[model samples]
Target: MSYRRKHTAQTFITNALALLFIFLFIYAGLSKLIGMSVFKDQLSQVPLTTQAAPFLAWAIPTVEVLVVVLLLWPSLRRWGFFSFLGLMLVFTGYLIYTLYFSPYTPCSCGGVISGLSWRSHILFNLFFIGLAVLAILLVPSKSLEKQQ
Candidate 1:
């Protein structure tokens, strides 16, 4: 109810969300990097992705780490949000594609995160996409007058 309380509440929410994003990205990236055998196994589970599995295992983690770094910086954070949004959308699309096109379900996503069914996968992507959108929307825009 108090002005100070409201500001504190808003700051808490923003920082919490940022921390969540940072943790998830870094953890997942490390999982992929350190668990290559598991990552490969998960990728091989998808019929069409078998050939692409190796490349993705290496690439995804690198991109994720970069995104995490970008998101941590105040100035470059929008690019991070945008990149994450795109990545999540692509992942959601992959899940949909695999659900309908692939003969077998890919059990290789990488441990707990990878084992999710198509529906859960879509929901997962949507959750992050929502977060990225919220982050972008909440980011403050500075004016030239403020700079001077």
Candidate 2:
């Protein structure tokens, strides 16, 4: 295809990925915040996070919302993709640890995501992680856009 068509396609894919992450983060964050008690209890049950449950119970949702804000702004969208990728990697790593190393795996994931099995959750995170990587690659820097 032509340069313009390719650019348009890339822009569309990037925007779609951003919207998906925005929705995921906002919904999951709100769900956790709304069910703070349950979330904290779940976190506390995890051997690794028991001591930090109270702080992390609040921090996780706050960071999720912050990421949504970053993703919403054009200039900061790249950072948002990076942040999304980082968070996904961390979460997936923790999932792997819980699945293999930990005898008891307590999931503190909020909303519909909490319903997924440990293995399924890892796959879900991997899918989003792939999308985040794609978005980062497809999103043109401001300088590049200006040149184009």
Q: Provide the overall lDDT of each model, using Cα atoms, as 2-decimal numbers.
A: 0.76, 0.91
Residue range 25-107, candidate 2, lDDT tens digits: 99989999999999899878777778999999999999999999999997899999999899889889988987888767887
How many steric clashes between backbone atoms does each model show?
A: 2, 0
Whole-model lDDT, candidate 2?
0.91
Off by over 4 Å in 1: 1-12, 44-48, 142-148
lDDT tens digits, residues 45-86, model 1?
787678888898888889988888888886777677778778
Best by TM-score: 2
